[model samples]
Target chain A: MKTVIINYGAGNIKSIQFAFKRLGVDAQLSKDPEAIEAADKVIFPGVGEASSAMHMLKQSGLDRLIPKLTQPVLGICLGMQLMCNHSDEGQTNGLGIFDVEVKRFSKAVKVPQMGWNTIHNLKSNLFHNINDAEFMYLVHSYYAEICQETIATSHYESEYSTALKSDNFYGVQFHPEKSSLAGERLLKNFLNL
Target chain B: MLTKRIIPCLDIKNGRTVKGVNFVNLRDAGDPVELAKQYARLGADELVFLDISATLEGRKTMHDMVLKVAEQVNIPFTVGGGISSIKDVDDLLHCGADKVSINSSAIKRPELINELADKFGSQCVVVAIDAKQIDNEWMVHLAGGTIPTKHYLFDWAKEVESRGAGEILFTSMNNDGTKSGFANEALAKLAETVNIPIIASGGAGTIQHFIDTFKIGKADAALAASVFHFGEIDIIDLKKELKKQHIEIRL
Candidate 1:
């Protein structure tokens, strides 16, 4: 299977690529819209600020193509946040894939909720065979509020959406690539789909 | 809520893990990739690889080693030691490291902290400080604790946080390798000074030491080398103890 990771000249996608390789899938990283559109699957991964990432996506012309994708496309970390309606990180508008907004965690909890946390209420096939009480790695200050599109929810300072699923589109707030065995299994499930 | 992290650090020289571990089970203790795999399987939250090598060639070798480890180990890993510039951070990040730690170089050019944090988000930059208590003052040391600096532990920690460093790794020079305990007093002081997460390094001989580091030290994470490397303390058992003590830890 040809899996192409969206490369918009922002953030490092090496770990994401290695994760797929470990699953015996050689994924390609490319900014060319044709290559990404031609692939069997596409992964949109990002780190750093939302506004800058959005700006880079726009400059690379990916902003116009990503939301239009019909095949299964997964967004990880910042990529997941950017797939929402908007983000408060830099007051930037997102791709409007998921009808939700990302907001900063209040002073109730730590700013950047780093480390392992459990996600419950697994609803989508994206989490097929994934059991409850399984820990996924999360490292973000902003979270997508619970919405109808939320496929999974996690408890932090308050309950929020950790994963979102729409028709042919999947997004996860945690880094499955860095979450060890459980993560590998989730990727395998996604690939088998 | 985020669980407290337990990190096992590996000191590498010329692409091989530094030797001083007394574990006989590890036939090739110098192999970092093998040790990394072992730690990940043991339920370690994260891993830090410190390249103690001197020559440029050795640094290059460490980069290659990072690639191998990243391919096999499925956990967030941080690389430290001899990182001097944005180029250094970029090279390591490109090699698949989750985070890059700067110590002596950060002290030499404090602005480097802001530079790195700006280029790569603060989450990717970690500033490591080696501190020692001298005359009732916790003074910062440079170049692996061989030299002392004017910066105090609390003062420098606040500065690093204000300068946009994502996290601070504080190691007590006197307590390091002693296994007596973590410098809780200084750790508490530093934690109060910065809102960012503080990783307590050095010491940690027993499971109770880890508990105290979180409870008393107010540390977000506890880091150790010999205890985990020499099999003096098993990570899974230690985490069980931490949970029993009411400290939140990933089991």
Candidate 2:
């Protein structure tokens, strides 16, 4: 199956591409709206400033094309936050794919939780092979506020959405590419879908 | 909740894990890849490989070792020692290292932190500070904790964070290899001050020491070398004990 990873001026695109390559999946990366919209699946990944990222997406018209995709789509890190209603990172508007808010972690928990942390309260097919308390790599300062779309949850200063799911759409705060076996499982599950 | 990490640090010389009583009289611990895989199976949250000779050798054999370790385990691994430039970081990350740590090079050239952070993002750069307490004030050390630097530990830590360091791996040179306990006072000071994650290194001898580092020191992670290599503390039992102490872990 063909997968198009949105490459709208964000970092970590190569790492995610390399990860898919390791999994023996051929996923193309593109900024062209046609290539992304025509793909069998889509992935949105980012690791930089949110406001500028959305700006790039809007400039490329991808910000509009992404939400119109009928096929299964995945978002990672800032990509996930941008799929929500709004982001605390740049205080900017999002694509509104998921009915939730992305807010920054307070000074109490520290920003950019960059390491291996356990994941629990998993509630979606994305975690088919994973279990409660499984460690997944995470590195983010903002978290999605809990809503009907939340599939998994974690806590630091308070309970928040670690994973989000809707029909034909999904997002995760953790980088599944950087996350080890569990992350691989999540990607494989998304592929199988 | 993301699980708190338990890390075992290895100082590799000539591709073999080595340890000493106090950063001297080096004794071989084991092969780098073998020890790293062992830690992974024992539920270590991560592994740190500090190349004690990377700077002198001018080659990153540690990166090669991390490539092998990454293939063997499903956990994250960080590489330190002898990282001087963005090219050094690029070589290591390209070799499958999850993080690259900077120490002496960063002290000599603080801009290296900003450069690496801009190129690779702060999530991949870790600044290691080997600190020694003097007159109740912690000072940064360099040259494998052999030389004292004028930079104050806490001030340098905040500076690194602001300058875009993703995390700080704090090692107490005075307590290193002493097997007594972590320098919680210094760790708390750093953890309390910075917005980045703190990995407490040096002087970890017992499982309780790890617990102490996180509980009192408030470190995001704890790194021990001799205790794990010498069979004093098994990573598996250590996680079990940490969990018993109400600390969240992968196991």
Candidate 3:
């Protein structure tokens, strides 16, 4: 399956691109609407603050185009946060597809959770080959709390949605691209979808 | 879990990697960009390029070289030498460098670390402290291990972290190029004193040296040069060796 990775300048797209390439899948990078619409699968990978990311997406009209997509689209990290209704990062509004709000983790812990954190309560197709409470790489301070769309969960100071799924739309708070074999397996399962 | 990193140090003199058994031969190893690409492909968790040649001519090429190597490889890389200001850090980051290391500049202006940490966040700035066993004390050295500073390493490491450096890269000049294994005592002290990650640099010869650095030295990472450049230990094989020893690796 051809997977199109949205390259909107804020994401760590290279690693994700490389991950797909390593899996022998032709993951194309595109900012064009037709290319994205034509793809069988899509992955939205992002890093940086919500406000700036929203600005860039709106500039390219991707903010609207993404929600209309019917094919499977995986939003990673900031990509996942951006798909929600709003985010605490930069006090910004998101695409509102998931009807959830992203809030900042309490200051009781560190800002960026920069190491291996486990994903419990596996409840999505994304966790097919992965085991419950599987360790995945995490690198964000803001998180999406458990909502109607929540599928898997992790916690820093309190429980948060580590993975969310709604129809063909899926979002992962952790980077499957950099998470090694588990990450590779997730991407492979994505291709099979 | 995120694995402990294994890095290969490439001392660049003019966009080329310089290698020496005891920092004396100074012969060319190859192109820095090619070596960096090879290392990344061969399972090097990270790469360190120290600009040994700070000549006016070489100085300008450093940033271009950084961009060149960063473009070819998709891995966390750090560039050091002649970094003095936040603007320098900005330039390197714009060139796609993941981290910037400060040497003499940090000692000359300790606040530069704070300035960089404040601007780009602590994750990008790495404080490279080159120290030596001087009179039974670990004294920080500067100008590529030529000059000395009053900053005792153990205390200075605490100070650097407070200023917002993402990590501390401690190199023992006396053991550098000596291949006598890393300064275990120095590394252990720095690791114990600092809460952040500590990259052990200098005095790496064999695969065992890398192991000992993480095991006995308690280093978060190990940086070596000749042993890596000369193919004494291939990076992938080295990581396999490290993994066998129960050390975490990306593989």
Candidate 4:
């Protein structure tokens, strides 16, 4: 199956590509709308500041195209935050794909909330054979609040949405690419979806 | 809950993985890619590659090694040593390193932290501080804990956090290579000083040391080179012991 990872000069996309490569899938990195639209699956990846990333998306016109795609699309890390309705980081507006608002984690916890955290309340085929409370690597300051689209929840300061699903669009606050074996299984599940 | 991290740091010199005792007396470990894959399989939460090479040619080899490791290893890893500019970080991150830890370079130019955070986001920027207690003061050191700096440990930590560093890796020269324990008192103070995560490095002799680092040190993560490289402490067993101690480790 042909897979394209949306590249808009954001965070590391090579790791995502390598993750898929290890899974025996040669995922293409493309910023072109046509290539992304032609893929069997699309990955929307973002890293860095939200406002600037949103600016790059608008520059490349991906901001308009991504929300309309019908194929299964997975957003990872900042890409996941960008899929929400809005983000508190840089006061940026998101693509409104997940119907959630992203807010910064309270100073009560670490700002970035680095390292591994467990995701529970699994509710989608994206998890597939993966069990509940499995740990996934995460590094982010902003998180989407738990809502109707929330497929998974993790507690840091409090319970927040770690994974969101709204029809063909899916977003995960954790980095499945860097999340080890259980994460690889989730990517495989996305492929089979 | 976010689990406390267990990081096995691999020191690289001329493209090969080496472990130095007390920042000197180097010993070869194995291929970096092979060692990284082994550590990931063994349940290491993350891995750090510190390129101790002093030559320009050796730094070039690190780029290739980073690419290979990123291709093979499933978990997250950080690349450090000789990284100073945005171009350096950009090259490594493009090569697929999840984070880049800056030490002496960041100390030289504090704005480097702000530049990196603004450019790549703070999540990818790790400011590693090497400090040791001198006259009852935790003074920051430079050049892998060899050269002393005027900055205090707590002051530098808070500065890095305000500068937008995502995490701080504090290695105590006094406790390092002792195999006795980590600098729990200093580490706990650093954690309290900054809201960002603090990774405690240095000492780390036994599984009990790991427990103390988390419980007493209050470190968000613990990093050690020799214990893990020499197979003195098995990560799986260490994590199990930490979990048994109610330390919230990934097992």
Number of the top-ranking candidate, with lDDT as the measure: 4
lDDT of 2 at B128: 90
By TM-score, the better pick of 1 and 4 is 4
Per-residue lDDT of model 1, residues A7-78, tens digit only: 886676999999999999999999998999998898999988899899999898898899999989999999
Question: In model 4, which residue pairs have backbone atoms overlapping below 3 Å?
Answer: none
* TM-scores of chain A across candidates: 0.98, 0.97, 0.98, 0.99
Q: Is the docking of candidate 1 incorrect, acceptable, medium or high quality?
A: medium
lDDT by residue for model 2 over A1-193, one digit each (tens)? 8998998877656567756776888899898888887898899998767888888899988888888899989999889999999998779999999999888888877778777666778898889988987777888778899999999887767888888988898999887886766788888998888
**Stretches of candidate 4 above 4 Å error?**
none
> Model 1, range B52-150, lDDT digits (tens) per residue?
778989988988999998889999999998999999999999989999999988888999999987777887888999999999999999866778999
Judge candidate 4 at residue B142 and give its lDDT. 92
Clashing pairs in 3: none
Error of 3 at B187 (Å): 1.8
Q: State the lDDT of candidate 3 residue by residue for B131-223, as single tens digits.
A: 888889989887657778899988899998889777889988888988889999889888778767788988998889989998999988899
Q: What is the C-alpha lDDT of each candidate?
A: 0.88, 0.83, 0.81, 0.95
* Reference A-B contact fraction recovered by candidate 2: 0.40
Best by TM-score: 4
Model 3, A1-193: lDDT tens digits are: 6689998876446667767777777789999999999999999988766788889999999998999999999999899999999998779999988879999866565445554567788887778889976667666768998998999998778889999988899999987875656777888887777
User: Best candidate, DockQ-wise?
Assistant: 4
User: How far is each candidate from the true structure, as Cα RMSD in Å?
Assistant: 2.5, 3.1, 4.9, 0.6
Cα lDDT for residue A93, model 2?
Answer: 95
* Per-residue lDDT value at A44 in model 2: 93
lDDT value for model 3: 0.81
User: Which of 1 and 4 is the better model by lDDT?
Assistant: 4
Error of 2 at A192 (Å): 2.1
